[model samples]
Target: MRIQNAFRLALVGTLGVGAGLLILSAVASLSTILTYVGVALFLALGLEPAISGLERRGLPRWAAILLVVLGVAALVAALLLTVIPIIVEQVGELIALIPVIIAQLNRVDWIEWLQEQFPLLKIDEISEQAAAALTDFFTNPDKLSELLGGVWQVALAIGSGVFAVIVVAVLTVYFTASLDAMKRATYQLVPASRRARFADLTEQITQSVGRYVIGQVSLAAVNGVLSFAFLSIIQAPFPAVLAFVAFLFSLVPLVGTLTGSIIIVLACLIPGVGSPLTALVAAIYYLVYMQIEAYVLAPRIMSRAVRVPGALVVVAALAGGALLGILGALVAIPTAAAILLIIKQVVIPRQNER
Candidate 1:
């Protein structure tokens, strides 16, 4: 009897372990779909504030959602129609100028100055090697084929990206339209005693997320517009393309603006594209812009959106970036806010009772 009981326990334990592993494997397999759902949900939450504002003005929910969605779609269409072609043209120009730029590297005044200052660093030798390698790569048939293969890979990636965008768009509309119902359903999962509190907390968290998203996008738009105007005024190369790059990078929090500014400055220093003076001017402009953004813009825009401590923000951003790259970093602050709220409201109260 004792042997039979032990055998039964071991069999059950083995089965449970196997089931847990199977569940994990299934989750891993569905990771991409899960990511799509998460992104769609995040966007839906971001749009909620707009919907709420329209509702406050006595607009019906359906009409409000429709208006906001159409507005966003129209804005996106306009950008694609006007800006995308210019950016593409600039990119092509940059690529065509690559060989010329490489050949003229030694003619750049700063390069000569750097070589003079650092005699031990064989800058000329390095430039020659790079130019020779590039020339060989362009002439070699095998290298041309490899380049074509890379282009094919890029085409495939673009297609996949388009598909993902469509999926997420559809999902965002569905989620936005049904968010109230979804919240009610989620509230139902809580016990009757806690349902009200849970709903309240959830509302606060969603609002915080919505505000953060709007503020962050506003900041990015500001940077992109200013960058384009400044670069164009200075006749920096590929203003449209660099501005688009700035816009994209500024979507990431914390280090994004700085990183984008550095890239733009480096682009300005490219031989034949811009001179040393141009690079210097661009750097100075970005330095001033960064200070304005950090001191004046960010604090005002983000004050109400998130209230996490400075130290926690740094830690959360780093941890989130490490774990899930850009998406994680984008959501980290609001997630931290939600956690802090729960701790203050629920955990502390429970501990006090204990």
Candidate 2:
């Protein structure tokens, strides 16, 4: 019987792989569809509490949903309004300073000192070629003109991204409004005698995910704000932009914080802000903040939530990021959490039953 089961499993796996490959080759695609659905489901689950709270205050379900979504939209618009102009101005300033940075770097004592030891090393050769090419192009340009053409393509990309955002928002609103109906339909798939048990477990899982996601978001926001404040105090260029990037990247699990810090530090070098001393200070800040998040904030906010182990978190983050870049990394934590939940719910329960 066990051998028969193994053969059946192998056959199912082989067929599933073949179908997946065929879909990858032939279908328009299910990737974006699935991702959008997942995002809508997550947004609905997150907003469920707010919906309940407003309902308790005697608001109609539709009215409560609309009010919450509108509030969220307004807050998001306000944040973009405040943050966008600062980032644009900072970015322009940084780009304008690039030539000055290169010039200053060429005159640095270290470069001259290094050249003395390595006389054959033509330090300025590559820069001179780039400068000559740029001057030639600008004085009488072609490729430079082509570069300007690319700006229009960027605008189109932005438009597409905005469209995607709108679609996601619409889906989220629909999902949130029909959450109870969706749950009912989902539970309908289970046997009648098991529906209550399934519902209870589903509620537990949703609550767990909600708590974990909310806590992680709060921690990321705090980290961003603190980082921006620290960078501003140290007179780092593009502090707000870097902090915003950090916040966005923070949705990815363990490695994101470190990746963001590295990017910020590299960008800091562009505008003459990141000195050795400042770099050391930044390192210390990261260490302190990471310690606090891991030991203090995370424990307080997410302890009763995920219960995913430290080692597993590290492994999942690394493996996921390696395979799927940022999306993989972001999905890894929840995937690991769900697996842990399933092990407890199924394996341990059955073991104890026996």
Candidate 3:
């Protein structure tokens, strides 16, 4: 009888393991879809504060959601129409200017000195290879055919991306509209005695996330505007393109501003159009701006939304970027805040009670 019971237990354990593996495989297969849904949920949460604000000012929930969605769509359309052409033109100009830049580099004293100092380091050969690679990639018929051969694959990828974006946008609209009802439903899962506590904790977490999103957007905007103004002042080519890139990069936490600044400086140093002096000035301006952002802007803007420690912010951003790229990094801070809140409110109190 004992042997029979042991055999039955082993059979059940094996079946459980098999089922778990099957579930895991299914989840892995649908990982991309899951990622899109998660991104949509995050965006919906981020948009909640704005929706709530509009509602407070007498707009119906649906009306406010529509207005916000329309405004965002218009802004995206405007950016695409205006910025894309300028970036394409600048990229073409840069490619054409590359040979000229190489010729000028050969004439520079630093290049001669460096080559002399490191005899094994063939700067000219390296540059030639790089130039040839770029030229071939662009003008070679073989490369062009190869690129064209993959056009179908590219199109399919693009279609998938578009479908994902549409799914996310639709989901975000729905989530924003029904967020309150969803919260109520979520609270219903808790026992009657614990519902109030759960509600309070959930509200704090959601509020923190909303505030972080709004504050991050505001900071990115400020960085982009400042970068645009500084680049224009320095007579940098493709200021508009650089500004748009800056805005996107500045959305990441911790190292985002520095990364955007480096890109701007590099843009200012483009072969024929950019000068070292312009690059230096742009770098200096960014350094000063970063200081101001750190000392003044961040404290004021981010203080109300979420209070993450500086060290933890860096770790979270790095880990998130490593795990899931930019989206991960963007959500990391709020996630860290939520975790911290949980530890503070639940973990600590439970430990004390014990």
Candidate 4:
């Protein structure tokens, strides 16, 4: 290598590595801040449409804001009242069976099959293994609360997380009511010559995110209702609880729906509602629903506004789950869709023009 060229190459490599590490450290520290920002943005988007409707109803601006906020508060209050009792009843039923369920696991046919497949596996003592698994599963305070504990604990955890949500709601009201002012402020930040392009990108992102929120809410409602219907048909206990789980998890992208299905399947197995055939029947049911959702349901419900290919949906969901657990996975698809919109706006137009 020529000495000067080698020196330049090494300088560029060092700079790149330095930049990467800086970004990583900044992200680690700033993640909490970014989370609040994303929450505020999503809330603003969802509330903006409702706020607009109120404005068009000849409501004064402050009155419109108050109406929208109060309306949301009423919904939240209703959920707490209506859903908690059902969840608690079902949860008591579930935990009451835990010791019995643990015993039942040792008696499953699959355990013997596993022993035969690896005879020496019992060198670890099969009973001890089962006991240890149960012990560990119930030992973690957070995990156990989510699973084996009373419904009240779960509800308390949910209530604890409500602070961020309340803040987001307050921010959303201010942002939505002043959207036009926000827009003008945003434009002022850009050089006048570049404002048009910036405005277009901003508008595109707003529409995409808004569409995503509305679509997911509608889809979740449908999933919740369908799940309740199926659970009720099978005479499964806790139909309402299962349906509520479906509704909440539905906010998650692809994986959330899958999880809700598996949960219902497990709950049914608890009651022996469809015991031997439960998993198979549940799988087949979702397979049919998945087809309907992919082809007919999403297009009509989501307005083809965010075109997430099936393969990409799975990839994004898995990646999001690996990185940040379930909530990340839920938000990942729409985030991907927004990024794709930006890329298409720049790349596709340029390609066609070329």
Highest TM-score, which number? 1
Tell me the lDDT of candidate 4. 0.77
Candidate 3 lDDT over 1-354, as tens digits, reads 699999999999999999999999999999888788778778888888888889999999889988988887898798789778978987888788889989987677876787899989997888789889999898989998888979978999999989988999888877877889999999999999999999999999998898898899999999888877878887897888888888988888888889988988987887678888999998889899999999899989999988889999989999998988878898888999999999999999999999
Candidate 2 structure lDDT: 0.80
lDDT of 1 by residue, 1-354 (tens): 699999999999999999999999999999888888988998999899999999999999999999999988999999889899998899899899999988897466865887999989998888889899999999999999999999999999999999999999999999999999999999999999989999999999999999999999999999999999999999999999889889989989888999999999999988888888998999999999999998899899989998889889989988888987887888888899899999998999999998
> TM-score of predicted model 2?
0.80
Candidate 4 lDDT over residue span 201-306, tens digit each: 8877776667777788888889888987887776666788888988888787776777777886776666333374755676678778867876788779876547
Ranking by TM-score: 1, 3, 2, 4
Report lDDT (CA) for all predictions: 0.92, 0.80, 0.88, 0.77
Residue 182, model 3, lDDT: 94
lDDT of 2 by residue, 1-354 (tens): 699999999999999999999987664466666767777777677777777789999999999998988988898899899999999998898788788888878776765676788889885675578789888877766777777889889999999888878888999989988988888899999999989988987877777666666777777888889888999898777789988988886766787787787877766665364576776677778778878887898788778767888999889878878876665676677678888887888789999999
Against the true structure, whose lDDT is highest? Answer: 1
| RMSD of each candidate relative to the true structure | 3.4, 5.2, 3.9, 6.0
Which residue pairs of candidate 2 clash? none
